[model samples]
Target: MTSQVEKRLAGLGLELPPDWTPRGQFLPFRKDGVLVYLSGQICEWAGEVTHTGPVADTPEGIAAAKEAAKICALNLIYRLREACEGDLDRVDVILRLGGFVNCHSGFPSSPAVINGATEVFIALFGDDGWHARTAVGVSGLPGNASVEVDAIVRLKD
Candidate 1:
């Protein structure tokens, strides 16, 4: 059966990726009690880094970085689904999100870029998706991807 979260994703014209394998020596997500901690996900799809290089502070750069951030969020959602045993409806709340934007030193638009991921969660989970977040510019990221995001989620009993 399709979960409500899946339906919401369809309504938003989005779908989770088919598969995601961690590229490093870490689990994609770790569960502790009712909380699931998701590792960072970059803007990679089908094994290809979609957005490489540091983001510039221009309109086009921000826009592209935003899209990259969205991709990262989708990937994180994929891991979240796995952690929830393929039932996203089991999610109680998105507790927090940590976003990193690969950009030049002192880039001021990291928050704007990370909003891409925040919007996705809100669209999919409504009030439950609202989360505390930290968005920061970084000199570099793994895979040289433009954006990466990690999450913490609470699960319903």
Candidate 2:
């Protein structure tokens, strides 16, 4: 059966990628009670790591970083599918999102970049995707990715 999320993705011309493969010791997500905590996902697509390096503070440069942030959101969507056992309808709400941008020194627009990810979720789940968020600039991220995002999701009982 096609999940609601799958249908939503289809409408957006997107599809969930394969099950997330953890690159390190930590699991991609851990569930406790009705909540799922997702680990930080970097900008990776189709086995290729995209959008590396520090984001500049210009319009064009920040746009590129925002695109990277979108990719990270897609990665989280796939991982969320796994956590829900392929049934995204079980998702109750997106509780929170934490975004980190590998930005140039003095760059202060991380929240703008992270909005790329936030917008996607809102499109997919409507108000259920609206959540608390934190966007911050960091010196660097693993694999030098331009953006990374982690999420807190609540699932239906």
Candidate 3:
């Protein structure tokens, strides 16, 4: 396999979760004319939930959710690239994303934390780096993970 994604992960010094799971019926991504719509994803490693509390807003929140968001971005890269047959270079735009942070009260910087994902996208995609996004503070999220992300990407055909 060509190493666009593996190289990206190695450059970041990160490992795949070995267990990121999709909680819903929808497929993780759908492609239509250079657009990839990613399903919502949470921090699951080996079918187990991590960051099992308020995301980025509590003392117990895993520092890794932010990191996980970065990882998720990597996962997104592979998702899109693989969908297009390893053509990440054909990626044209990030259409939208709904950022869900499962947090308790007093979560002051959820946006900042989610920026971990945002930064990774910018770094990886460069000019195709920005998207319409919503960062929401949710009472709870599936699997009780601290953060979850859903994205829509547009690419070159």
Better of 2 and 3 by TM-score: 2
lDDT of 3 by residue, 30-149 (tens): 877767888777756667765565665543454666765665565566566667676566677777767777777767767765776787777666657787788877888777777777
Q: What is the C-alpha RMSD of each candidate to the true structure, in Å?
A: 0.7, 1.1, 2.7
Give each model's clash number.
0, 0, 3
lDDT of 3: 0.68
> Residue 32 deviation, candidate 3, in Å?
2.2
Model 2: residues with Cα > 4 Å off, grouped in runs: none
**Per-residue lDDT of 58-145 in model 1, one digit per residue for the tens?**
9999999999999999999999999999899999999999999999988999999999999999999999999999999988999999
In model 2, the clashing pairs are none
- Ranked by lDDT, the better of candidates 2 and 3 is 2
Q: What is the Å distance of residue 14 in model 1 from its true position?
A: 0.8
User: What order do you get sorting by TM-score, best first?
Assistant: 1, 2, 3
Q: Name the top TM-score candidate.
A: 1
What's each prediction's TM-score?
A: 0.98, 0.95, 0.80
lDDT per prediction?
0.94, 0.89, 0.68
Which 10-residue span in candidate 2 carries the lowest summed lDDT?
15-24
